[model samples]
Target: MATLNKSVPLSAYTQFSRAEWAKLSQSTTEILSALEREKLGGIDETISADEVNDIYLPLSQLLYMHMTHSVNLHENVSNFLQKKTKKVPFVIGVAGSVSVGKSTTARLIQALASRWPNSPKVDLITTDGFLYPNAVLEERGLMKRKGFPESYDIGRLIRFLYELKSGYAYIEAPMYSHLTYDILEDTVQKIIEPDVVIVEGINVLQVNKKDRRIPQVFVSDFFDYSIYVDAEEEDIRSWYIERFKLLRNTAFQQSESFFHRYRHLSDTQAYDIAKDIWTTINAINLEKNIRPTRHRADLILKKGAGHRVEAVHLKKM
Candidate 1:
């Protein structure tokens, strides 16, 4: 695992080592059960309780501080205006490259944040749900460019975020299935007014180039706070390969899985295929679309070789 550099001379962000950040958990004692902890991670991730205690608990507490402050600020404005307003969700965006364990980070935040006193509801919806359906991608000849910004229904996504901030009573986000590796038709995740909404995906921090000229609201515009999970490109590639190999014996065996054809591949062949996919598709997407947006985040979680968060970089106001 990488160690934090003590001196970050003349940086725009304040840096914290893992230990330094862990000390920030002065409040919030709510903890997930062992079973709950077991259920908090993504495929091929084993997040130790110590890691949660040393990392996520502080993160959860920090989010609570931000969440309450946002509510207070909203209340103050409403009072000054002498008008009643609907409760708006505090949106948090988690962005990162594929296989960077961002899904786990998002889920951990959602689970821990929801467990705070009085149990505020924290809803999570990934940007994968907004990706153009496989049918649409195929029609547009974007199957090879699936994770790219152009492959998503960016208009619809922007509208959905708009509605959340607009305080819609209930909104339906489209559903996506990893097994089929496509958007599920006629299925949606109905989200009521959640106190916090964590939108996780590689695309969350992106600013579409087309929007620059038109001056349109972006996905991050709706985010009250945003986190970008960072790591070495080669580390993520290795993680991707390991996950791919693991899936060959797991999800790939499912008849309905989009990659079911790869179920019978030998370990060596699986590595080769995974390497090829990562090299040609995922890595390209990360470089061109995802990693470029990391600097835009309010907070960046720098991960080391073992998927450990070695340091934290918080943007200075």
Candidate 2:
């Protein structure tokens, strides 16, 4: 097993210059299979290849290395204790402000990690499935803070992760719909012994201390690694507005979308609406809750105004 000096912090492990960082971030030639590539292509309007290369590829590689070493250590310990070998899944937590590209990061990491020679079966899951339905949020008076910690079914989320890490062969997680903004009743997203699992959400790592009844094993307790995608407040606000405008022009125009009312807006009106949502809702959430988890990440990807990652913060090894 590789030894990470216990006394040394991970941040000091390696310092890459601008060129060096970019070089290290390059993607390998082989990615997903043809069918998977076609499916992922549909999301390209939101996520880009350059972003995947600079952010997700390197992050996934780092996680792979970390997982490999962890497995080796676990095997050594098991042998020392004369215990039987057991399967252990590597869990990665991706957290950030809504519209800060956490979803893109999650998808890219899912694709990249699965391509890793060491970990060939990686699965991606989101905490959206754990969110209360819009009706439930409205009834609970939490409609305004839909992505808040209280808006989640924390018990179910914890149980799912626990089962996955415990080597369950076929674990089921709820399915969530962005168009309906609700959980799909009786539907499940199945997982079958994945080597790596990426769990993405706005508050994946939030620990509630006020509720003494809350168990010590929070949602993030299962993570073997964690990533926080970060950008400046101004940059993120701009990106959010742009994404909202894009959705208004496309997805929001669909009859099935809950926000179809946005389809009637003129370009100028749509821009204003997007700005309003960003400034009033998303911005408030970022400031009040999301950004606070920055220090809790195992790795941090800091993006520039151009939306490309400029620097990386890996917790000292």
Candidates in order have lDDT scores of 0.88, 0.77
TM-score for candidate 1, please give it: 0.94
Q: Give the distance in Å from residue 307's predicted Cα in candidate 2 to where it truly belongs.
A: 2.4
| lDDT of predicted model 1 | 0.88
- Locate the minimum summed-lDDT window of 10 residues in model 2: 1-10
Point to the candidate with the largest lDDT: 1
Candidate 2: tens digits of C-alpha lDDT, residues 157-207: 999998998889899989898876678999999998788888999988787
- What global local distance difference test value does model 2 have? 0.77
Q: What shift in Å separates residue 268 of candidate 2 from its native position after superposition?
A: 2.1
Candidate with maximal TM-score: 1
In candidate 2, the residue pairs with backbone N, CA or C atoms under 3 Å apart (3 or more residues apart, or in different chains) clash, namely 9-316, 9-317, 10-315, 10-316, 10-317, 11-315, 11-316
